[model samples]
Target: MKQCLHFLHTALFARAEELLAKRIIDGDPLAYFLQGQLYFEEGWYDEALAQFEKIKEMDFQALYQLGVMYYDGLGTKEDPEKGVEYMKIIINSNSPKARHLKYAAAYNLGRSYFEGCGVKHSDKEAERLWIIAADHGNPKASVKAQSTLGMFYSTSNPKDLKKAFFWHSEACGNGSLESQGILGVMYLYGQGIRQNTKAALECLKEAAERGNIYAQGHLVEYYYKRKFYTKAAAFARRIAENDNIDMLAKITDCLPVYIAKGVAMATFYLARCLQLGVGIQQDQAAAKNYYSRVSVSLQVHSVLLLVLPIDWINKFVSICRR
Candidate 1:
């Protein structure tokens, strides 16, 4: 059973998958869960949905999986209302089987509220639900909630920089890659803490090497502002050149939207350098082309949320004002 569970996550093991499927034929509940997981991971959403729906009443994990699939419209039409109800079932369950899943469910529920999915948009309720999930912050699964709380506090109107710093600090310590990169940003800018260039550089450099796009974005800005035009342009060009919408969609599907801000930032800086010919070879036509992509966004549930943070608006405004 353990091997089969591991195989569900490792696509290289076809034999183990066959074994798990065989077990499913015998009505093994655990096999069903593992099978659903395998299908979900492989992007076989419709099959995964069918498997999960069958055992959702008995398996907390299946219920949670169903909630996520329905909410996200994975292999099915969007049904945020049904998704929320499934999550609520897991949250309200008194069964010990639900103990390990409640925190994650709460976090997802908080995101639903925060994003106004199947629920009224309520920062107050979102904050409340997230706090519950964040309290279980020691677990790997809990780290996402911790990191999201930081993002929420940092960007929401009437922002709480202090709390944002605290939550980000907590999430970073809990091993959230996103939070680790954001820590660099906050330290560099003194968002809610004392400015520490040395600490900021260390954090950003380490996170950037680990592929934290947020850190990479800020690193580009850091280089550009310091007149390290060559290094800045080089870094930004790498990200800008790989502008595949499908790839970005896959990334944003799993990561927070703000990560797109990093792509936007990198692209914007690269475009600026090209326009000014301050770094590398300047190409006016190339500069204009890149500028056009900085404000791009992705559509979700009929709303075009700026996954790209198309934050170029802020940058363009800064440029205009100058």
Candidate 2:
């Protein structure tokens, strides 16, 4: 016990010295980025911005990170204008890294226009920009554009189900978890597609395997609905065990897409596991935390149900009616 305590003390003090040395490290762009990250985490936005700005030659990733900070109010005040300014500079550059940033820039600019954030609202213009981004292979933008196209064609004078399917397919093929999850929903609901439980499960499984947390959360239900109780319980264990924050962010960021439709399924699976203590160590507190998130989602969904369009209601009703 004394040896263990001594080792812990030495480890702690060594870490402190290492941190101090890191703070004094100079002439390193990566170090500046690291410092900027530390400052941002501490809410010292101005100091973080200064560190980021001291880089002698900004790489594409640095430019992208700076844009994100500007947009997210991380190391600077939220400024879509400045964010897009940096984005445009990289977008016009010939660097290979700039290609992805170019698509991201177009997507952000389109969103700004669509939401009238320091710009005018123009659906046509928004679609144009989204198409440009999608064409350039931005997975996020492709998902957005495809989903938008699906919605547009879903309710129009001359509904083009094929067009909707094409866009959704494109987005799904490009590895957009959002698109994969949505395509699963469309298949489950027979929206511009046949209702195939097997196909829907396949889509969800693919997305889930790709670290789409939302899909992982939703897959719990699809497995359950098929009476694959063991599979459902195992899936919950996998998600709870996953340590990757980026994958978690995929689920956390677009949580509504899954929570709105998958909460009941997740709750059911979670309850089954907690009651049986299957695979995971039984923890009521953990189960309650997940339930609480589902509850909040329920409340938001209830509010959204009030404003849902008639056509959307009809479509859902049609699925239920089947």
Best by TM-score: 1
Q: State the lDDT of candidate 2 residue by residue for 1-322, as single tens digits.
A: 9999999977875675467447657444455566666666656778767767665256666666677678767756788777767766776788785776666677676776677764678767776777777773445554566555554555445777766766767877765566687677668767778788788879878876765665666677567667776778777655544434444555544435343444434553565566456645677766666555445554656743532335644644453344
**Per-residue lDDT of model 1, residues 71-174, tens digit only:** 99998999999899988998899999998998899999998998898999988899999988898466555788998999889878888999999998888887
Looking at candidate 1, the ten consecutive residues that score lowest on lDDT are: 298-307
Measured with C-alpha atoms, the lDDT of residue 205 in candidate 1 is 92
lDDT value, residue 201 of candidate 2: 76
Off by over 4 Å in 2: 1-47, 55-61, 92-97, 136-161, 208-257, 264-296, 301-322
Best by lDDT: 1
Global lDDT of each model?
A: 0.81, 0.63
RMSD of 2: 8.0
Candidate 1 lDDT at 92 equals 92
